[model samples]
Target: MSTRRYPHSSVSPEEFHKWLSTLICVLNSVYFVLNMITLQKLGLGTMQLAVATFAGFCLYKSSNGFYRPWHSYALLISLTINILLSIAVMDLVAGATYWGLALPFWYYSLFGLRKGFIFSAIIVLSAAMVIFFRTDTQVFMPYRTIFNFTLVYCSIWLVCHIYEVQRQKTSEFLHSLALQDDLTNLKNRHALKADFQAFQHSFESMHMLIIDIDHFKNINDKYGHDIGDSVLIKVADALMQSIHTKEIYRLGGEEFVILFKNINDKEAFRQAEKVRKAVELGIFFSHNEPIKLTVSIGISSLRPEHEFTDFLRAADQKLYQAKREGRNRVCA
Candidate 1:
């Protein structure tokens, strides 16, 4: 196997984002209480009910699956409508403009730039509409609030864009890591295992061929360790060249396993013979000399009741038989 590292599989980042939603919900509850203290200041009924209802929705989202990015956007829409309806038309024309700034932080961290920006625009425009219609308060309200809101919005937009770009790079890096063989840059045993799973349900009618190079240790001893490494690379190239979308696996040292998904018994036998002949036809030329190479192959049909390991063991036994009988041939 090639020496590249493949990270083990794990849960997706989206699956772990629920805690963020819950934290936001708790914050909403706190904000709701503070807003309620302004009840006599604003009036008794409408604005207070509107804020409390939104807090209740946040709590519901926390307890349910509503914390996802799409749901957060939907909740923002609902809150916008509620705000329009509850605030006195004259009071809305005044200077209470905050729901816009607050809602984006709830969802933006979890999404990419285009989507996060769109969501922010939606909330901001919704607030602007209410603020446009509401207060004429000259006390706390000024044209600078619009400028400040826009500044904060642009800052958040840049941060989210950078974050998404980094995440995408990391995902691609992980994908490349998965396909690499840890020792040689060849495909590893894990790749073969994944292809096998693809076939178990869809292509139950297929064959397995397992190949092991003959007298490899003798070469390692005859040549130096560096030469031995070169021989392994040449052998891996030969196998890869001969196989057809067949998964090539380095099972350590001189043993390699190739699996061709969705081929019948006779076709599989033909394919195995082709590989055996291609590998054994000549020597692997490295440096100025030709180093003769031959591989022994064991072929087996996958039966309905046989587990993957069982089939592999059967193929392995045939491989040993080929070595015992004389190498450079295939056996079933």
Candidate 2:
């Protein structure tokens, strides 16, 4: 299988799900053989065999690069059913009942917070009901068994819930760090590529605008790097204020990118002009000294066969043309 890491973590959810399912498959397969051959429990063994087969099939498909989200649900649901069936057949003393405790962690890891909590609750309540009603009170005190089981289950559930919460918070923070510009607080180049892939198929036509601060090196030379940073921040603010629908991205240094959707070339040029005038007229201050700034914008329309880089290259070429003609003009 591929070993691609997610932006937030070393292992992607698909990889985790594959490994978890593989483990379950092996365990269930071993249990099935044991039950069928040694324990002489045909019904439970058959159920285990079925769950193992399903898990194995999912693994095979995943290895072949045919993974799907429903495959995860199917495997988890089948395993849960098999566990419940085993509990019902052998009762609480069979040792399968303890597996319910681990289900919370698995569910939380696979389904995430909301669905994980839901599935965990279902399994916990279902297993509790089976233990409460099925236990022999004379041999094993039903109340004590239920009480201890519930207490431990709840403790594990709480821990899993807290861990999942923290995991989600960390994942979001890392994702933001990966995709956001630290200085301007705008989306970065990686975010631009990601967003392009997300929305490329949704819109019929798209346009890109590459905006560059005119003579930005001169600004840093005359003032300072700190003042240049201040200028970039102010320019980002102006871009945010000027555009309503499109998202603005800082593509490192003094360059920014904006994506426009469902607009013609003329409209895209008009929007770029609007942004240019906004930056030109705005007053930027660094250490209480007002600095005048102008931005050159390049506009490019998405072509049928264009990839993200090609689209970006087209706009970048136009940006160079804008800089060649004049510093404060817009080119398409």
Regions more than 4 Å wrong, model 1: 1-15, 36-147
Instruction: Tell me the spans in candidate 2 whose CA falls farther than 4 Å from its real position.
Output: 1-10
Q: In order, what is each prediction's RMSD in angstroms?
A: 5.7, 3.3
For residue 64, what is the lDDT in candidate 1? Answer: 74
Clashes of each: 19, 0
Superposition error at 226 for model 2 (Å): 0.5
lDDT of 2 by residue, 1-332 (tens): 01123532246667877798799889999999999999899999998999888888888888888889899898899989888888777855668888888899888887788998999899888988887777554697767877888899999999999988888789777777888899999989988898888778989989999999999998899899999999999999999999896468999899999999898988998999999999999998877788999999888898888899999999999999999997899999
| lDDT value for model 1 | 0.64
Worst 10 residues of 2 by lDDT: 1-10
Candidate 2: TM-score? 0.93
